[model samples]
Target: MALPTLHYLSHFEPSGYGLSAIAMVRALRNAGYPVRWTPLKRVGYDQVAVMSWPQALTEASHWLRDDESLSDLPALAVVAAVVPLAGAAGFTIAHVAPELLAAVFATAAAESAHFERVAYTTWESDALPVHWLRCFDLCHRLVVPSRFNQAVFAGDLRRPVQVVPHVRRHRTNEFSAPDLVELRSTLDIAPDEFIFYSINQFEPRKNYRALIAAFVQAFSSADKVVLVIKTGSIGWADGPFFEPVQVRQHLQQMLLRMRREIKSDLPKICLIDAANLGGRRMDALHAMGDCYVSLTHGEGFGMGACEAACAGNPVLMTGWGGQLDFLGGDYPGNLPYTLEAAPVWPPERPSFWPSQRWAACSIDGAVQAMQGVVASPDEFRRLALERAESIHMQLSEPSVAAAWATVFAAS
Candidate 1:
């Protein structure tokens, strides 16, 4: 029998979801499945041109034109789209937010033939919102990225949920020595300074407020330690506050407030505001960090921390969520936290379900985690290096290919 053409649909932009879609396409092709790639055009978000995409994704870009008609999809093809479906028929995998499932169903309903729908979704809380159950009934199958997410959805949905981990594209091994030196020079990072790097949007669940407070409380200017933060706004989802300048202003006001309360010299912070530094440049950025830190309240999959760990940086993360499936239980760099109700920030627009519980990372624990890294940098780096190999192997091309193969086979 001939291999089926995978009709993969996703946004081809700079955000996490966009990159993961590109990774999935690369993996599917490597698994010997012919693919018909389609880009999901969004209102405000701009898709990256095919020529500018990472080298691996460039090969798959030729599979189909961006404006190609999906109405004429091949008979032997299976459709998989992220979030809002593009009105394609047949086996449809909708990678969407739980709240948006109703919209996904509505979009698919426009099609005449019944498409076997699969919801590829995830929730960060121990239990998903009670309201989502009705939406869950619309899908024929459900797929999630982690066991934690699967458990959250399975019992309530009363269905077998498949766990396929996110495909991370890292160029750690490919980064040259000169690339590292140039990146360091570009950032003005000194040789003696120990760097604590973090990459995330200025979102409520990310808990940047806690991370910033802990960093200042943990180290002073005399320690020669700097916190480098890389953040930018997402056009599709992010509000005005997440824009680089606004984020910088928020950080500035925060530090100013901390200075008044603490009355002590504070360490410097370097903020890089860009949509995303993709491919080998991302590797070079990760290579420059002495340690990676995130005090996030919750995560469907902690991509930044995972990428940093894979690149051999000691990760200081709150010990909870989907990340635990990959980061493991006994990882030395795990930080301490208390499980509590998720907070309602920016009261007008809540990022989380306040009734549902998520990790509230201890400020003291974050401080201690940073201090421990400062105390014995070598040991942390050594542990991270040891885990990096296993992470690479676990998420390698063949492993991801096999996982996707299973998903398609069962479909």
Candidate 2:
């Protein structure tokens, strides 16, 4: 008998969900699995052109065509995508939003072929949404990227929840050397000053407000260091850009108010307002920077912090969330957070639990971490180097392939 065909259904867009889906399919096929692929779209597929991820070293790439997967690597196999019926013992695992999970199960109810979960990594929030709690009954297993997320989901889920983390690759590896001159000229970052980098989409959960407030409080214009923030007005995995006008206005107004109240004006903060930085240029930007920081409220896997930590930057993030998967339980760790009623986010996000309370990192804690990087640069470097080495080993292709193979085989 032929090996059962693997039907890989996923969201194919420019966001984290789409990237994670690409990484999974690539890792599995790269591991030598004969897997087939399809798009898990909810609407019209004609108008939009799904982007091929791993955009250029210096730019994000998009092309309109008939192809589904982008990598030059030839596919191992192709298979039919059919719905699976209950008790069919089929295999499949997917990462979908709360609203999509029920629809996914409904698709599986009759055919059962699509019902079998082969195990895939999906995101979980700081709190599980109440309305979707009932959907858990159909799932036998759930794979999340971080322990913090596991705990949050487990509070309501009866199924086994495992932590697989992200299979993120570093773009910094492709660039042979730093392009400091071009980088400085582009961002207006001076040679003498130390650079502190914060790269995130301009959203409420990232805690950009808290980070900027802390940066202004921690250092002044006289200080030779500057905070360089690379941000875009995009929300999360749903993949639509928020209005840059409103995002910019809110940030500027808040910073201005804080500056006025503090009686200081130091144009030391620089913002790269676009989201489409090329991967290589982004890597070089990281290389030129002295440090990276994220005062995020919470994370499903803290991909940004992990990327920075892997790239050998001294990373400062909220002590909680998915970063803990790599940052572990030690110093150079959590920015120290307290669970509080979840703040109302921009219109894009609607799935969090205020009663359960998400993390709100302390401003003092952020100051301590930011200042420590300056005060004892050598110590933080040592720690960052350690994190870089460890994560490099674990997230490497072979290791990730082996992990995925084990899960798929067991499934």
Candidate 3:
């Protein structure tokens, strides 16, 4: 049979959604399935082309409403709609949004006959909205990245769901000693110092402040440990709902206070803003980290953590979401000495969603975790390398390709 043509949609510019779309498309294409990626402009102010008030209002109204013509894309055997489905497009594989299932269902309803399935990655119970049942009723199948996600949607939506763990490519060869030495020197990091890195956007939900606090606290006595944070620059306030500047300012203040209050010889801090890195440099940045950590309050899928793990680094992530499925219990060697609690989100904060409660992790917990890694640097390094090797088999490109082929065939 001729390879099925799949069109993956992404909205944000090179964001988590965009990366996921690219990874999925690349996997499918490599597997001999024809895949095309299309970047759909996010609506509202950030839209590529400026629009008049009337035009913007009209487009918003149409999005809030529905467009039946979206289903008319010919040769499109499947439409893999990432997170937020752009205003009700008619596509066969309507990858419904886990958070916005109702809206996706309404959109998909316009061409119920045209689409055969809906896919989503549900990491938490609350990730899938209550209306998911209604949405699932309209879908012939549901695709999830993990069994945890599958259970969440299957039990709630009362529909059969398939589990396809996120794909990752593992680099088998270890970095040369010279490469490691150069990387450490370039970052002004000591060869003996233990490094804990977190690569995430500077979003409130990422709980970056807690991570920073934890690092400062954990390395209070140690001058041989460093916490390197890689994140994107925060933008101006978009509306009452999204204020990136306010959040960034709050985090900056927190960091300053921590620096003053925490008496660490290492002083524990480095910020690698994503805005500063591009192309090959970005890959090098990720490759240099000794270990990757994420204490996200919520995640559709812990793609960053996975990528880090693939790069032969131990991942210190919240014990939730799709990470649980991908990491599994087979993490080689003993567990890193600490697994911190999730951070708490303050009330009245826009980042706090109604469905989410309790802090993802506290600064104290993060500090303890970092300290543990520093104290036993050799153990952590060995475990990280071993864990990478053990999981490499599962996330291999060929394995992921096979899984994608199965999903496509089923669809």
Candidate 4:
């Protein structure tokens, strides 16, 4: 019998799912599996000698290798072959939704073979959406980033569920002394100013508006504090796409209701479009901040919070969902929260929404947490340091990689 090859399908980009796919590939390869990568969208499998699709990733050129333009990957070895459906021999791992899997399924089915198929996904609701349950039928096993997600999704699943974390190793500070100096200067922020940073798309579930409300309410304009947000995505901006001036204007307008009571001493706020930034730059951004905040309704796994903590920035987050797996049972760095009914995809929209329950954080509690942190920097730093150590230990590279490879190997 031939060796069972590992065929992985996912985007080699920077979003949460994409990052998980990249990390899993690395781990599996490190575990010495014969792995093949299939890019979700267009990919150049050039004959230029590359072993992995993640090797093709370059933010400078829209997910292409630095040395190669996205011509066809001339080498057959670089591109994963569509396995035969009737008698296919290898296992297939898909990081895409079922609707998106139609093409992959068809191509793989064209050949006469059958092999194991596994699916990995991320979700934030208390229960799996009805639309996605059917997709699980196609997979032999389900792998999620958090146990919370596993519970929410496993209610009616046919296969076993497993938790594999998305982990990042400790990074060498990407910014030099001069780079830090220039960065603060460029953002019009002074070294003496205490900075609170948050990065996310302006979506309803992300609840950025709540963070803004709590922020402006917590501190005054006269205070030497700044809320630096790297966010975008407007009326039609699904996520990354940003209209900076317009987006900021929209946020200021959203604050109008509470503005009257803000006493007119609005906190100094800076908004930047989180577009076209590389990994190193992202690391620098996280490292430069005094605290990182992400106030979301729920998360399958709070990737941003994990990254911020790993970067050593104190995090003020909504204490709920999959994050609990590593944030500690009590969620030490998190703010106080309340369990609320599930919300639709767009919190603003009411009628056409999925049924998924999540937590609604108390803005007043957030205000208190913010005040408490600023009042004693040392205390918050200690808390952040403790969390950093705990999270890293739980999600060390070798352990996480081995866990991922185990799941792949099992199938």
Superposed model 3: Cα runs more than 4 Å off: 1-5, 45-91, 94-115, 123-127, 131-138, 170-188, 235-243, 246-249, 259-266, 330-352, 355-359, 362-365, 408-411
Ranking by TM-score: 4, 2, 1, 3
Predict model 1's lDDT versus the native. 0.69
Best by TM-score: 4
lDDT of 2 by residue, 1-411 (tens): 223334455666545676666666666666665455555554432122222222321132332121233433222212222322233333555565545655555543444454455334444355676766775665566667677777877777756676666777623324444457767877777777888988887776777878888888888888888888877754332113333455556667777888889898754888775444544556666778888988887778876677788878898888777777787778565688887777443344455545556678899988888888988888888888988898888776667767655454553
| Candidate 2 minimal-lDDT segment of 10 residues | 49-58
In candidate 4, position 309 carries an lDDT of 83
Candidate 4 structure quality by residue, lDDT tens digits, 1-411: 334567677765567776666666665655565566766653332111222434444332443232121233334225344322343466777776444444554443434226577677777767665656676676776788899988876774655788887766433345678888788888899998888988777776688878888898889877888988887645322223322336766876766656676548687788777664445556667878899887888888887788888777788888887888877766556777887765444433232144556778889988988887788888888877888887888887777867765675673
Among the numbered candidates, top lDDT falls to 1
Tens-digit lDDT track of model 1 for 111-195: 4126566677777777776767887787777788888888878877777888888876534335567877778778887778889
Native-to-model Cα distance after best TM-score fit, residue 163 in candidate 2, in Å: 2.0
Error of 1 at 169 (Å): 1.7
The per-prediction tally of clashing pairs is 0, 18, 12, 16
lDDT string for model 3 (1-411, tens) is 665554343332345553454455556655765443343444432133223324433443422222222222222223322222333322334333443444444444433434344554454434454444554665566777777677666666665677666666322224566876886787788877667788787755676766666666655544767777777666333223444564446556766766666543436566666655543344565667777887666555677787777676777766555666567655432122222332222233222345634235544555565667656767877777776675677876678777666766663
Looking at model 1, the pairs that clash are none
The CA-based lDDT of model 4 is what? 0.68
Off by over 4 Å in 4: 1-4, 42-89, 107-113, 169-173, 235-246, 346-354, 408-411
* Full candidate order by lDDT, most accurate first: 1, 4, 2, 3
